[model samples]
Target: MSSEKKNKMPLGGIINKGGTCEDYDTGGWRKFRPILDKEKCIDCLICWAMCPDSAIIVEDGKMVGFNLDHCKGCGICDVECPDKVKAIAMIDEKVAKKG
Candidate 1:
């Protein structure tokens, strides 16, 4: 066999036309939405339809994900869940910072 080496491109070498990586650190701008407990969810679509940002996704017979980037922690989903136990809740930014 001939002695040869294959060169692999560096992962960061690829950048958008703006010369910035898509995965650049956001400096804690993102927020986390409280996940709903399906067993306690009661299949109420209140949170899904009431979300102002349309961040909640219901897919394939399951509540899939919340789009945190646009959520702004408006608490609409939490209040509208209609569960007496209040399964959905707003996790404040301060608490998120510590975690």
Candidate 2:
């Protein structure tokens, strides 16, 4: 198959450019947001890999936190994390961001 066909999304069509998602901040769109508990985290980077929006921030090959600016509160990271070690939790944005 051609390279383009091989790289095509299963849902079809180029939804957006790759690695440029951060340019558009979707923070206001989130109802719930993923909060990281650094104490409980193992830094396995699972959330980094599972984030569809590339919202997980990494530094020196370790997951430090999420870039809420582009995250849409999808919760894919929380769901993909191992059951026993729930380092990422989705919490109401209002409560989490309370002043």
Tell me model 1's lDDT, rounded to 2 decimals: 0.65
The runs of at least 3 residues in candidate 1 whose Cα sits more than 4 Å from the true structure, single-residue gaps closed, are 1-35
User: How does candidate 2 fare on TM-score?
Assistant: 0.75
Which regions of candidate 2 are displaced past 4 Å?
A: 1-20
* Model 1 poorest ten-residue lDDT run: 19-28
TM-score of each: 0.56, 0.75
Tens-place lDDT per residue, model 2, 1-87, is: 576577547465555657665577888899899988888888888888888888899999888898888899999999988888899
Error of 2 at 75 (Å): 0.6
Q: Model 1, clash count?
A: 0
Q: After superposition, how far is residue 14 of candidate 2 from its true place, in Å?
A: 12
What is the TM-score (0 to 1) of candidate 1? 0.56
